[model samples]
Target: MIFDPSPIELPSSYEKVETTGHVFVSHYPPGTPAVTPVVIVTLNRPAKHNAFTPQMVRDFEKLFPMFDVDERVKVVVLTGAGKTFCAGADLEIGFGVGKDRTADHRDGGGRVALAIHRCRKPTIVAMQGSAVGVGMTMTLPAIIRIGYEKGKYGFVFGRRGIVLESCSSYFLPRLVGHSNASYLVSTGGVFPPTSKHFGDLFNEILPDASQVLPRALELATEIAENVSPASSYLNRALMWRDTGSAEAAHLIESRVINHMFGSEDQKEGVAAFFEKRKPNFKANLDDNPPPSVPWWTEIDTGRSPKAKGPSKL
Candidate 1:
């Protein structure tokens, strides 16, 4: 499917990033019962198969955070131009080659991974074509991923003579399982989405690349309309980073549920159910977050040992 290149209304800062031409950004027009402004972000490097680069890293750093904080953006949908999603890093250019100590040099893929991970807005990635190495690992941070059944996927770092970047060491195992993660990384071989080794990594694998983005948009529109943004983000955070014990989890959830029970969204949800109508949930994560978020010990995204918060977000 050909993606429309025309731009949508955006904040000044986000508009600047869109103007860079590294990535395409637009707000999707929602279908019936869905809300407006579901943002679509596409990698614009079809000529290069959307290869990862430092400039791409910098663009995502600026782009996703803007999506997270902007009230107009309901969900972020990611895809690539042309038939190929991403071909991994452009090895010809190499990676970060600074004189800075190994300790100081951050993985470009990891930096973008964390930006997607930490963004309050939920993300859905449409892997319309093959994704390898950094292309595969970096997208692990997204909440949902839809892939083309014909496309190849891999954890190819072992073959590349480098360890996993993009914190895939953590996300890969948790996403699939330790054993499945082991098999994929150990082989460092590309496999189709139907490969059993992939397990649960892909939420859905469509038979055609043309179906990828449309299916993703359908899901995004449903989320934008019927779901509470604050609830969606908090639920994922609770799953990925939870409290110490069952007791703590219960308490945390109880506090959050109590807040939700009285929230405007709660009322709207119930009313919509009774009226057989779609809900118009307006709770933004920035403005209507549940209490005691970031309750887990915070590791610095910089990979520092220091702890920052077990406090409210």
Candidate 2:
């Protein structure tokens, strides 16, 4: 059955967004113009080092799309509330606790990772003190990652007698190469900020944890102020999705160029350059998207049950 996604309702201020429990959603750089704002999602379980639970995983999955569909939000910054970012999953509750596995079930961390991966706006993660296992793996799907120089990261799934979760098998190698990924997964050792591997994981490392969020907000502000919302969303989608080949990318580029050539935003961008003023981008994803936008189709997972087979000899 075909169903439409429910509309997202954003609060007037960051303080008004209902957090429910461990996850807090808010806006960054308060007092900024509403045209293009930066939203922040903070993991608020500081007492437990912001350790994730199944509920936190579900909250993250729901929050990404909420901010993505909101026209006012241009970027999303994910961070932790306290000194440490996340110390991985909460061991007290245990993983896979109450889940029924009679049929195929998706990993909880994978759900959150995929949500961030599929977000239309730019997603940035700010890592603080220590991030291990699912904590480190979940951030792999973000577009940009920033952390402290003294931060610690680990992929300890091997030590726990389990495989990596959050689809890290697919994303880890892509970010840090196959050899590095293999070594990290197999060893399950912690990488300190000074380690070469740690440097590879983060885009930039600040002096300490306190600087991570500030740096992230600065970058988000730059993106929100200067770029067009529709262009940013489409650009992110094209890069993340597999275009198959160079020719496929070329075709997409041509289609986008053709659609944007005579767009209102394009004309204003040019005029602003000549006039030496900030360009007012009135085009948005909901209202004035380009004609060739939404170039990809959703994959359908429905299928018939497996047929019975004869016994093998």
Candidate 3:
């Protein structure tokens, strides 16, 4: 079941560049068109240990669609920019509080999770430092996980007074076992990746930080080289979705769609999609959505997707 890859040329669509804002964005890396293109997404906030802010999550939500529809983009690579993969959320400033879940999600309500699960192309989490809070949840949906020898993974929601928003509570237990999931969830402490957990959870572990991405890329390319383009992604998606929290995903989407329905952006989106044109959103979503008095309230599902276990999140 394990694949080892030989280096190959990256397709033209795959380009690695630094954005004007100094963000390192690797786009459409090889494997997408051939097997599953490796789309590398690095958290740009190294100063904050790549702590996922609500804005960052929102950007992710926006960026996700770019890859989702790109048939050339099959596999995805999620990592951080600096020493720490992600040190959880920025506690002092507050993250994910009163944030718009619709704007913060890759597909707005576990759509990313479901896409990751059902992606015919594979996903790999290259963790070299701490992956906490939403950071941890973000990678839970990946098919392959690689942690550096010194890397520490933590789950800190209990200490922070936040419930697992990324639905890690439902997915992590399945990945690492119930007991291990319990210890991390209850304590909000860091745990070294053990063989029992990592062996089952991570596809590989490297000796140093430098080796993590290389090894992941190697594995990605190997899979890309051998598998048929169509079959590789379809198979990967099927395998991943099978392990996801379907109910959790459904709840997420239901909430997001409800929120969107009230927004002018939703109107733009529907008209645009129907007309085969780009949407012109009226709101400045990059600044984050307005806070709701009832943070946990759900909107009426007058026109929501029917809930099916696996088909949901």
Single out the weakest 10-residue window by summed lDDT for candidate 3.
304-313
Q: lDDT by residue for model 3 over 1-313, one digit each (tens)?
A: 2242232232334343223332345744433433234677777789878865655645554444445434455457777888888876677766444556755533122443543443334677788776777777778877788887677877778887866656576688878789977777788886666535433666676778988877777776665444333334334433333424777556544554455565665566677789986554433322233232122333332111211111100
Q: Which candidate would rank higher by TM-score, 1 or 3?
A: 1
Error of 3 at 7 (Å): 33
Estimated TM-score for each candidate: 0.87, 0.87, 0.61
Residue 83 Cα positional deviation in candidate 2, in Å, after optimal superposition? 1.6
lDDT of 2 by residue, 1-313 (tens): 5355545554455546565688987656554434237888889999999988888877876677666566667788989988888898888978774577646678878888887876677888988678999989889988788978787888999888878989898889878888888888899998875666554778888886788999998888888778877777777777767577999889988888788888987898899899998777767555556566656665442211111221111
Q: How many backbone overlaps does candidate 3 show?
A: 15
| Residue-by-residue lDDT tens digits, candidate 1, 230-259 | 778888887788576899889988877888
**Residue 163's C-alpha lDDT in candidate 1?**
88
Q: Report every candidate's CA lDDT.
A: 0.80, 0.76, 0.57
Ranking by lDDT: 1, 2, 3
Candidate that beats the other on lDDT, 1 or 2, i.e. the better one: 1
